[model samples]
Target: MAKGQDLRMTQEAHVTQGPLTTEAGAPVADNQNSETAGVGGPVLVQDQHLLEKLAHFNRERIPERVVHARGAGAYGTFTVTADVTKYTRAAFLSEVGKQTETFLRFSTVAGNLGAADAVRDPRGFALKFYTEEGNYDLVGNNTPVFFIRDAIKFPDFIHTQKRDPYTGSTEADNVWDFWSLSPESTHQVTWLFGDRGIPASYRHMDGFGSHTYQWNNEAGEVFWVKYHFKTDQGIKCLTAEEAEVLAGKDPDSHQRDLREAIERGEFPSWTVGVQIMPAAEAANYRFNPFDLTKVWPHADYPVIEIGKLELNRNPENIFAEVEQSIFSPAHFVPGIGPSPDKMLQGRLFAYGDAHRYRVGINADHLPVNRPHATVAHTHGRDGHLYDGRHKGAKNYEPNSFGGPFQTGRPLWQGIPVTGVTGETVTPVHAEDNDFVQAGNLYRLMTEEEKERLVGNLAGAISQVSRDDIAERAINNFRQADADFGKRLEAAVQALRG
Candidate 1:
């Protein structure tokens, strides 16, 4: 703990709602004093109120997220500026000048709840759009491409980031060992060690819907789409020294900066843009557009600006509003849907399952997660922390007693699947070679940026005890770019000496 910092928690200044009452609604006589034998005798065990308070307090914290445990969020407005009704029938994007209420959460991918905010990590850019139809979520990241194209490797990749079970401390060796062995990670690893890895602030970093999504028009024309939230603050980064010093000086620097900016009426904003492709174009593209490890180059399909995003309000209670907020890819509207991206396909099920376990089954009923529009039909009830709605009603459908019925929403035409049914590796596409894009990204870096990238990679690789793993990592970079490979090797050798 920092000097003069109290380990004890200060009392909450503000709380929600009316006078404190028992869970069953009997008025409490006194909250401050617990039942006890007269004047310093044995404390009574039959103190129901005291027991309830302590028990609830003990169980207050749910499981910290597997990834993205530390985060900051704000309430925002996403206003449509250009009509894209021909591309998507989602009500929020149906007309110009239409506004949709939104909540956006920014988080570090691998950090624990207490980790520093300014560390070199990809920030999660998740937004929930409470449209008239239903709540639609765009779960994305600060970077466009990912470490792996398949979700099956997600657990193993996360295991590398987390504290070593044996040592209970993060080891650089574990991270590099995995990355060196898994050649698929080359592109994202290049990105991680680049100039933009340590974003100056949440406001300055751009966000991408890392996986391709499917969108359909009212006329049932389907097109693959990707979202890009270009930050109005402009791109900025912190060098290694600056980030280290700031992390020690103020762990919550990013969180504080955002809140203070909003309070001063300096609202942070992003221009909502998208790179759209015709549904048939994926097959003929140089790379499989559905591959999560690759991105659709902007030169081919330029970003089309469609809306504006501004965060004007901070949360009233961080825990209640921000921490409890949930975003899932499965929460799609009629027009916007998922693609054949394997990672996305897995996330469609995995995200909701994780929420149900971490939050309750009725997580959607939470104010932050709930829709502003009326839900015509909702299934499943009777869970912990359930909202007091649909009482004494049939939980199932197809009942005669005026039960909730499904709306006649048009389902998009299904894409044909031709793969053999079995547990197997993702088939090698013609452009499955991951080195091309990583090399392209490396070549795009300025001379100074390239120097820093080599330094960053060397710093981590030098800590790796295994010579073979270190050599393999260098070889991966060599595959990316010859100059990059030699520079990193020379840097690491200097560090070793």
Candidate 2:
């Protein structure tokens, strides 16, 4: 019945659309049987259909992402709720009630394409805003802080999360060994082993633009900012037991829950807000403003509501729209730009480079990733699957051809750098102690929350066969808080017994 409807629809669309055609547009008479020498003989060389089918099937899949491979996406709308014209010159936030189309991809870090959706990992909360200016991708995570501050450690950190090469299994020794040495990972480690590690659903947890960004106004005034998408459904989490049960029962539980809810018209929404810091204040701030491993306290920089995002539509083709969708932190409009955050700076190059290798050179030409606004790029002329052209126009810039060209727009200029350039490390600030924030977070948790965190941490840490690695992990926690360390030590010992 489905085949008949598809064929009927195809037939009504074009003159030569109904019949199954070969690559050369020649119609196939018998798709069921291949041309052969005889009834019992091998297939004939003239079987183009068979060859085409097998060849295409071999190249069907592209390389999965190095990280955040397992993901779900949706289409949405972002409507501005406040006047932020004074803060940013971005067209999407230009007015009080302006609307912009968006795409949100939620995923688990360090997970493979087949990993359970309820696994204990940092949830990737990436959003792409398709505005009149261009695509502005706010690549972030569910948590405000990250495991590391420097981009140099990212590859090594992710390697620990992946399977060990020799055994092809996740090893707790590797995870704990790395985290125990890298003290910067303390804050994020505290978050991941907590109750919030296994979120009830993607829509139930808050999203954050983890890195501080730079926003410039029309008046050339600049401000450092961070974005937060507070979930309207409220924060919810599953216990370790609940997560394990659901993983065994339905590996793609979160995906199913989100899809079904949207299909039933139960749209999920988030209140978009920003924590703005003045350009000069960033220098005077107690902590280094660009540290990816730390978070600016809400009390110091209040989260001012700016807009609302509602996911009203699910993807029609998950593989085409969701899987093929690509985003880069470098994809910023005129009003917004990057900060000096090391991780973010690395991603600015890493994402585009990965997309070119994993997706294709012309990934931007794909429907889901293609810009909705008019594009006049001529520099990228030819590559695999090239489908665009700037006919009669010079490919090189500085040509005297009457064409769309780069506009020399004024930048939001304020501060100037006067520093030595070389193999330099991050300058230590007076408030650079990582344990302080982690301790604060541990202290803020309720008694029940603290107990759950200890249990979760113990369950994972106890898996480490080496007592040295386990003790190292405990020592790091001890530095954060004596009580946290004491509870975790007892729980892990109990698990071992």
Candidate 3:
């Protein structure tokens, strides 16, 4: 089924007038009672339907995602509102007013499957655009920056965010200890503890493609771009107190709010924009343009409006649509590719591998993950959930019987590389320290916002048992800004003392 194609064409009504049947389509005479020996002694093994039902029920669930476990998703459309051909030749973005079908999933980063929705955590903003060429997935977060720039440290970072091995609970010592050691975490930590940390609802927060991506035009000109999806519903946030109350009162607060709003026909939308930099300007820039921990300040490159995204429909089945759905940053259309951002590069491999291990290799055959506009003609076959859709077709290329061949044109322009790669720290640019941007963020906040940030930090830092760990964490902020550190240290001391 292609984008804009009728849903009725592919989907059939699940409820029918026929009697209840077994997996083999054989009608079952009695579904209510299981077969037993003489009606009471023992359940009989001869009841194939009973045995089958129990077995299937036992195996109903796939593994939950390691991250973004608790999430809500919706079906939507992304309409290109402005011409961006000068930047890229991606088919979906080739013309103004071109609309593409989309599925957006919002989630809390560090939460479990049963966690509360209103927690003070970064939100996942993963979007899948089913386009004419193929599916383009922009898996991102609400914040524009992350704790670390290198992917090598990602697992370690997430481990600290997750439960402690011994305590079986997240420890303040583990979290602050890692943050203090990794100075790169300062910027994201500041953002995490700020006013917007606890979004009131998924609909009211902004979304970002947090890594730098590559866009190329027809003439093979390359550009580095960052995506921004500003909420049309306006920015709304819950204070720490409000979030605690809401989380306890309604763990599904954000999820329910999104569903009810769409149900009421008040579709939440976002003004889509991008900040683009010429590939030539990447080097010699004030900061490392490819760093995942930094944002391309709006002062250097302003966001240009290009599209609109609105979520209008909730999924009929959460498990089949939301849980089974996968988004990989590696999913790219023509003219769009990844940058040298180490985190982005690592994710290119990790995301797909995780999905293959969790969902079967034929996971894409699931309707929600399938390509809409085009038929995928890959050689991959015969995995779990395999339907044999490509039966009798030659599975290999270079065959006389007309197998699918590769397109001669590359999806994105390639860059030149000269150095032998080993374990090497990324070459630093001017103004590339980890603390500057974080300190700058602190200074940019309003007085009230700064107070809240300090209070949040102090509350968490004071929980650490070791004074050395607390002081080390405070010193990072002090390096970022003296005022920030002073206020935070005073607050922590007052609480701890």
TM-score of each: 0.86, 0.86, 0.87
Number of the top TM-score candidate = 3
Question: What's the lDDT for candidate 3?
Answer: 0.87
Query: What C-alpha lDDT values do all the predictions have?
Result: 0.83, 0.83, 0.87
lDDT of 3 by residue, 189-301 (tens): 99999998999999999999999999999999999999999999999999999999999999999999999999999999999999999999987799988888899999999
User: Mind giving the per-residue lDDT tens digits that candidate 2 earns over 1-497?
Assistant: 69999998788786544787767788866543344333312233355565554333323335887788899999999999999999899888999889999999999988889999988999999898887877889999999999987655666688799899779998889999999888889899999988788899988999999998989999888999999999999999999899999999999988998899899999999999999999888766888888888999999999999999999999999999988899999898888987777667667666777787778888888878877765536567778767756555667777777655778884334345544332234545678787989999999999999998998889889999999899889888999999999988999999998
Ranking by TM-score: 3, 1, 2
Q: What is the lDDT of candidate 1?
A: 0.83
Please say which candidate is ahead in lDDT: 1 or 3.
3
Off by over 4 Å in 1: 1-62, 408-412
TM-score of 1: 0.86
Which residues of candidate 2, in runs, are more than 4 Å off?
A: 1-62, 410-415
After superposition, which runs of candidate 3 have C-alpha atoms over 4 Å from their true positions?
1-62
> TM-score for model 2?
0.86
